[model samples]
Target: MDFARTATWATAIKNLNPDNDLSVPLSDFLRRGQHFAEFCAFSLRESSLCDFLGEACKCAAAACNAPMAKVLQLGKSANRLTVIAQWGMGHDVVGSDAGLAEEGNPPGQALVEGTPVVVPDLSEWPDARVPELLRRFDVTTSINLPLIGRSGPFGILEVDYPQAYQVGPVEISFLAAVASVAAEGIELMSQREALTVQRDLKEVLLREQQHRIRNNFQSIANLLSINAVKTKDDAARRGFQSVERRVFALASMYDHLLGLHEQRDEVDLSRYLGSLCDDLQQFYALKEQGISLHCNRRLGMTVDLNTCTTVGTVVNELVANAIEHAFPDGVGRIEVALTSNREGSVEICVGDNGRGTRVEQCNGTGLQTARQLVTHVGGTLTLQSDPGKGALWTISLPSKGHSAA
Candidate 1:
């Protein structure tokens, strides 16, 4: 039969036998009902563990026809079981504590034996804890089903009726199946909490690493600056200056990457490239040289750290080349524009209003470095230089170049 027809039959049989008999047909019906209850338990998006447990307690009580039900969670003390959720026994008996494994208590017996503990009549029961607990609440029959979780028995599902009733093995099994679903919920919650803790710890470690690496880069830059000042050879001094500029470029990347530490290795190219241009303008002293550096942001995109770094390095080389050679008279305007082309590729354009070079004349170390860096990011570089008018360098970045190999 279809699920709807089977479900209807199961509900009718469940209503007929509130005590839940052990007959084959009844067992199958109860099993189907337990499966449905379990499906609901896992699907519930309750606000808290207490809310989830409360729903679970209600489902158990309704399925067993019991007047009262309680969900007891293993307490922090390990030896104490505290009532976290309840049904029927109103007025909120939550925080009620009972021994975890006391020989006489029903909950304790279930925990100790790793199975269900059923008491047909608490009045004649030898367990003093169970009798006292039931008498105070005017309860007679009780069943405690252990919630066996990954960390052993972590809780108990208790169902109680006002008068005496017989509980067979089949009935106990049905309750145990429901308890397993609750146990899974608790286990899932624990795992989520652990993952959250691990994620938080990883973020902390990443921030620390970023800070340490920045300090080390600064130390190296300081040492290089000192050596460059002491160098007597003109060529050696210029070499030192070039190395310092490259080091500063790397350091700039580190500073920006540190700002995005929470984002892992991803970078917002718009912000990152804008910051790099600002640093370059300051480093090259373009303003003092009567040069205007304009940064135009036309696209907002994010790429992996490797792509950002390579792109940043290329920009640094090309912009620095323009500052040194494009404006030999120390007077010109350089424009850097970032945008996406018609083909959805990121386009980086750096141009200067000064004398430009031919395509075949791209033999300098800076141009060579820029060309190599652009290729590394799976991009193409085009240099256009005309005498007296200007020089324009365009780097077309690939659409899928954001991912690292």
Candidate 2:
């Protein structure tokens, strides 16, 4: 596996998409690719197949010593080769217009005829549209091999080399192996995308389920609050205040979850956290008289519904706990900041200035539960009281691609 060959192949590919902004030259393409069997193994990984497709194309081109290579997909209308992955052509032209004609399109024909097609000097022929692009890439000869999958003809890998270097039987056999990886990569890419879509759909369904359930529970809580308050006078009603606070907490949590856009597939953590703070301020302003919740900036992170629930629940607990225990005199400020760090982790800090608690004294049941949830997700939660001032609870959580479906 020579790196020079890989570089040539990679150059041919990098030029395909004029919109690609990446500047990593041949750094990622020098692997020389193990055997063709490794292609199957790598393509089977459920991740970014765009990388798989591009890298596999380059690997095949390098292995064959061809000047240019392309992994072309078939269109539905018939006899159409869509250049999904490419490696050899120097020009920006793609698809049938790149040089492969309707008739001399060796790769498309091979994919359709279920056999390999070889043209020693594609540019030498009078009917070849690829000559201009071929000359630009310094390609003299080329071969197209079909990559057949479990279904039918998936796509074809076309390789172009110097004119004197004609493709022999050994090269065809080797390309056949490369095409196998290409086929598997395409299949795996399709499967991965489908699985991702299914997982996202399931999250949406789960969020919808949570919304309905929370709404129903909130309705019940409101009814119970009214009934309990009605069944007693001022002294008994005073006792029911805690119950009402708990009910409001539950109601706020449910309402927030109910009014989200999970169908859009990504959750904005900053907007949600801010809205939660806003809801708490509005809720406690009525309960305790007058207190303001303030935050410096709008913060956000794209996350899953489950992550949203966990983070939102913890935020509610901390902010609400602050409102309840610390600032009972009704005049204070709650400060919050959410940051998505340069290292890809998100940090959320909810602090207040009125009253604070010591670390030992702040270890209540709710705080303990919140800490457990944060730590279980491979993150940390810390609470510090300002000693005659307000308390600050900071939660740092890891936001990966996402959990399972």
Query: lDDT of all predictions, in order shown?
Result: 0.75, 0.63
Estimated TM-score for each candidate: 0.78, 0.50
For candidate 2, write residues 327-347 as lDDT tens digits.
Answer: 767777777787766666777
Q: Write the per-residue lDDT of candidate 1 for residues 242-319, one digit (tens) a residue.
A: 888889999898788764542566677878888998988888787899999998976557777788888888888888
Instruction: Mark the 10 consecutive residues where model 2 has the least summed lDDT.
Output: 3-12
Task: Score candidate 1 by TM-score against the native.
Answer: 0.78
Please list all clashing residue pairs in model 1, or write none if there are none: none
Clashes of each: 0, 12
- Residue 336 shift from truth in candidate 2, angstroms: 19
Q: Lowest-lDDT window of 10 residues in candidate 1?
A: 4-13
TM-score of 2: 0.50
